[model samples]
Target: MRQHSTSTHLAQKSSWTHPIYTKKQILDVQTAHRKASSWQDRVALSTVKVLRWGMDFVTGYGTYSPISISVPKTRTMTEQKWLTRFIFLESVAGVPGMVAGMLRHLKSIRMMRRDHGWIETLLEEAYNERMHLLTFLKLAEPTWTMRCMVLGAQWVFFSGFSLAYLISPQICHRFVGYLEEEAVITYSKAIKDFDDGHLPLWEKLEAPEMAIKYWQMPENNRCMRSLLLYVRADEANHRDVNHTLGNLNQTDPNPFAAKPKIEIGLPQLQQNGRVKD
Candidate 1:
C-alpha cells in the first residue's frame, strides 16, 4: 500500500514536466485578479507596517537601521522593488532557521538527549529560503551596487537574528512569525500587480524553472500568479510553524508538526473564449 501511494505521488509530480497551459489560459489568471482585493488592503500594512515600523519595532528603531537604509520609498511590485526585496528578505529569512536548528542540535548532544525532531524542520526552512534567493537572482540579475547591498544586508541580519535567537528563542521565533506575515502581504501585493497587467518585466513570462520544479506546478497553473501563490502559501506555512514554536516550551512534546498543504488551482477558460475564474 505504501509503495502504491509513493508511485502515485511520483506520477502526479512528473505530470508537470510538460507545459499544459495556453497563453489564453495564463491571461485568464491576470483578468480574474483585477476584481480581487490586494495586499495593501490589509489593516496589517497600516498597523504592522512591515516595510518600516514593524521591523523598526522588532530591532528598536535606531538599534539596526542599516537593514532598511538601502530600500526605496515605493511600496509597489516593480521589477526593481521585488528584486531588492527578495534579495534582502531571503537572506534574512534563512537566519532564524539556522540559528534555531544549530542551537537545538547542540543542546541535544550536550544533554545526551533528543530534540523531539524539530531540528530537521528548521534546517529545511533555511534551505528552502536560500533556494528562493537563487531563483530570484535569475530574474533580477543584480548589478554591482545591488550585490554590495545584498552582502551588507546578509551580514547584519545574520548577526542580529543570531544574537536575538541566542538571547531568547521565543522572541526570536515571534519575530520570524511577524517577518513572514509581512512576507505574505508583500507577495500578495506583488501577485495582484503582476496579474493586473502592471508589471512589464513579468508580462506573459513563464514561471521560473526553479519555481516550477519547487512548487510542482500543474500544467495549467504554471504562470506568474501561480508562482506567487505557491510562494505566499509557503510564507503562510512558515508563519504558523514559527508562531507555534514561539509558544512552545522545551518540556512540550512534539513542538515540530507537519505543515498544512496549499491547494493548487488554475484560472479556467470558458468555451466562449472568456475567463471563468
Candidate 2:
C-alpha cells in the first residue's frame, strides 16, 4: 500500500488583496455626504436614516459628536460596547454587495449578456466587509445575543436588499452609498475617541495579525488607531464608488474596472498611482 500524504497547507492569501494606504492617505479620509436630488436618492437616503436609527437604538450606540464637543459622561461607550456595535454593523454591511452581485450574475447568465464589470466590484466589496467583521471577531468573541442579532439581521437584510436590487439597482446602490457614509462617520468617531484618550486600552493594543496582512499595514502603524484609519478609508472609498455607480445607467461600464487618473480630488496613490472621479 502507498503511504498517504499527511501534510496540509494553510491558505495564506486574501482572495482580494486590499489596497495599501499611506499613513497620510488613511488619516486624510474625511466624512462625506451626497445630497439627495431625485426621488430615488431621497428614498435611499431616508431608508438609511431609519435603519441607522433602529440599529443605534438596538445596539445602544451613542450619538457621535465632533471631538471638540463634550460627550455626555453617561453616554460613553466602553471598549466592549464599541466592539459589539462594530460586529453588528459589519454583519449587515456585507449584505448589499453580495445581493447585488448575485442578482447581476444571474441576470447576466439568463439574459446572455455581460455585467460590464459590475459583478467583480460588488463581490469584492462584500469580501472586504467580511474581512472587517473577521478582524473584529479576532479581538472580541460575540455573545449568544450578539450572534442571534447578527443572524436575524443578515437574513432580513439579505432578503430585503435582494428584492430592492432587483427592483431598482440604482436606488439600492444609493442606499449602500448612504450606509457607507454612516460607516465612515462611525469609524471617524472611534478614531477621534482614541485620539482623545477615551479608549485607553486600544492605545497600547496592536492590530490583529490578520488585519495587518490583509491591509498590508506598515510595521510602524500597526496599532488599533491605524487599523481604524484603514477601515475608515475603505468605507470612504465605498461611499464614493457606490454613489458613482448609482449615477450610471445599468448597462454603463464600471468606471472603477480600469484604474483611472484621479478619484474625487484624491490620488489613489496605492493603486495605479492615481484614480479618476
Candidate 3:
C-alpha cells in the first residue's frame, strides 16, 4: 500500500504547466493599451479605470505618470508596500478567470454543447494567477486587515463579474484585458524601481523556489527582477489574449488553444528516487 501511494504521488503533475520564457521575451514585454472602439469596450475600460483608482487609493499607491514627464518624484513605495499591493492585485486577478470558466462549464452542460476551448484556457489563467499569489505569499504574509479586505473584495467582485459575464462575455473579456494592461504597468514600475537602485533588498533577493520551478527560470535569472520580468510578460500575453477574445463571438473557437509541446510526464525525482517538490 505504501509503495502504491508513493507511485501515485510521483505520477501527479500540475494540469497547467507554465510556459517557459526566454530572457529576451521577458525583457521585451512592454505595456500596451487597447483603444475602446465600441460601447462595450468603452464601458469595460471605464470600469477598469474606476477599480484601479479605488485600489490605488486604498493601497496608498500613487498615480502613475509617463516616463517622458520630467517631474520630481515625491513618493517612493517600500518593499513591504509593493508586496501588499501585489497580494491584493493577484487575489482579485485570480477571480475573473474562475468565474468565467465556471459559468461557461455550466452553460455547456445545460445547452449540451462544447465550450470551443474557452473553459481550459480560462481555468489555466486562473491557475497561473494563483501561482503568482502563492509566490508572493512566500515573500510576505498578509495581515488580518488585508485578509478581511480580500474577503470582502472577492465576494463583491465575484458576484458582479458573474452577472456581467452572463449578460455579455465580450464586455467581461475586454474588462479583463484592460485590467491586465494595468498589471503590466504596475510590474514595469516595480522593475524600474529595481533598476534605479531604489529597491536595494530586491536587488539581492532571489525568487521563491516555487517561482523558479514554475517559470523554469535559469540558474542565473532566478532573482526578483527576473521574477517581475516573467510576470510582466505573462500580463502582456494575457492583455493581448483577452482583447482578441473580446472581439470574437461566443460561438467562435478560441484562437489561442494550441497545446503545449511538452506533455505531463514523470515527476522529477531526487537521488533517493523520491519525487521532488
Top TM-score: which candidate number?
2
lDDT tens digits by residue: candidate 1, 130-188: 76786676566667766776677678777876776667776666667667777776676
Residue-level lDDT of model 2, residues 1-277, one tens digit each, is: 1111213242567678887888889878999888898999999999999999998888777744664456565567767778889999999999988999999999999999988788999999999999899888878888899899899999999989988898999999989999999999999878877887778888878887778888988888888888898889999999999988887778766777755422422232224332233
lDDT of each: 0.59, 0.83, 0.82
* TM-score per candidate, chains pooled: 0.66, 0.88, 0.86
Best by lDDT: 2
Better of 2 and 3 by TM-score: 2
Q: Which window of ten consecutive residues has the lowest lDDT sum in model 1?
A: 1-10
TM-score of 2: 0.88
Clashing pairs in 3: none
Q: Give Cα distance to truth, residue 167, candidate 2, Å.
A: 0.6
For residue 245, give model 1's deviation from the true position in Å. 0.6
Sorted by lDDT (best first), the order is: 2, 3, 1
Better of 1 and 3 by lDDT: 3
Taking all chains together, the TM-score of candidate 3 against the true structure is 0.86
User: Model 1, which residues run further than 4 Å from truth?
Assistant: 1-76, 258-277
Of candidates 3 and 1, the better by TM-score: 3
